[model samples]
Target: DIAHQNKREIYNLLMRASADAVIRIAADPKHLGARVGVTSVLHTWGSAMTHHPHVHMIVPGGGLSEDGTKWIACRKNFFLSVRVLSRLYRRLILDGLSRLHKAGKLRFFGDHAKLADLAVFDAFLQPLRKIDWVVYAKEPFAGPKAVLAYLSRYTHRVAISNSRLIRVDDRGVTFRVKDYRITGPGRHTTMTLKTDEFIRRFLIHVLPKGQHRIRHYGFFGNGNRTANIARIRELLGAETPVPGLAHDNTIEDADAPARVLALPCPCCGGRLIIVDTFAPAQHPRAPPASARAAA
Candidate 1:
């Protein structure tokens, strides 16, 4: 359990590394050689409420050219090659794990105790290099609204939504799950698990304290996003029908309120404003040093 507890860190590292790899590949002179933007959201559960960590990234169909004077559009119905992305993603994650292991940042216990040994750890990671990892990319959304709607569904989701829950009686917990193996209506099925097992599975998906499940990268990064985006807009030309394009405003900029108000309020169709700020609750203390070392 202690070893598995750091999965949130692993997930974050994997996604960030994979995104960097994608950007590097996409920016290759032979490929696109343009600056791209990506918004990645981490999902840690499957329909069966199992620990199935993955990232959903939204990337524009094109990017700004390296010269910052032109826009580069990708080929129709295609982005980066998934096969290349998968291979790179696998390597990055495995290498990251190896580094963590060597740094004594990773813990091991119970069935995974052998991984504490350097030889065993190396052996454990060796097999991963041979297998293909999944790194998928879909076609661009219809519009900015479509992208926002899609993000809203996943950005805040938990292991299992209330709508999927059928019952939680003394015997166990029941929920509806989509059996992707079958097609159409037949894929929908109900599953029941012992109460303890259900809770255990759900708890595994709970992220580490203060961990951000959503992250932006490349041109979308917080530091230079404003300037980079403004250049992209200029390259695309004012006549282009890019939805939701507006003036750039850095967090330090005085025009930050204008940026905040740009988002429409869902309740009354007015504007969202930051009326107050508060510090986050303190996280519970970790296991004792001796307890952790024992694991």
Candidate 2:
């Protein structure tokens, strides 16, 4: 509830702090005074449908020079150093939180009500400065289509998807969950919870009304994005291509074979043919085709 109430400020701080870190790092003379752009999306749920807030930032591999005369590209397989990013992000966020607390812009209730006291709030944030905050960066997308696909999957997703729901009855709601602790076939499992409990979990993701989850920064920001992009493309000596789907099919084809390997029995190392498909809330029982097939 507190998170939902303060969603706007939290999201804004996250976006600003992260973008500032990138901009500061890129502007260093060693990086050739490059100006980078970032697009960030706020995600508030984990894989098991729990409240875990994080931001996913999509950044171009490099940036244009400060004078907009040359393009500065990052070295192969690396963006900014994660260590540097993490330290800067941690400091920036903690500082912002402190200022907000001092200004009485933050609200605290329930167990955190004690944080309303200035001293307690300062103490609470003091330890955070010594800890390393997580700031992850992934490999660049294959093309614009991959970027589109990623945005589609992540931007507006709720806590749980309809396909994962198995059943809803008086007893509870059952759903399939991926147990990430175990690898391979053993990872899939089912969990059931009361209807009210299910709703409670889902509602944890409800953002504050009118809060914008997607934000753009640097050259992609709203203020002068048009002029900035034009300058960048001109510097790179390339015009913006027509907006269309990426023609590369190799990215999609790479994952196609996983379906064929799905039915392997982990214990017996044998194939398990589907005898019957179970409806929602019911688990499928597929016996191995050959008993004791493994040596």
Reference-based TM-score of each model = 0.78, 0.77
lDDT, candidate 2, 1-295, per-residue tens? 4455577787778778988988888778765368888888888876667777778889888887777777788888887888887898898998999888878788887888988899998988888888878787888889876886777677766788888998988899999888767999879989898888888888888888887888898888899898888887887777575544323321344657632323434333234565577799987765666867532
State the local distance difference test value for candidate 2: 0.78
> What is the C-alpha lDDT profile of model 1 across 209-255, one tens digit per residue?
88898899988999999888778877776544445644432134585
lDDT to native, each model: 0.78, 0.78
Q: After superposition, how far is residue 28 of candidate 1 from its true place, in Å?
A: 1.0
**Clashing residue pairs for model 1:** none
The true-structure Cα RMSD of candidate 1 reads 11.1
RMSD of each: 11.1, 11.6
Steric clash pairs (candidate 2): none
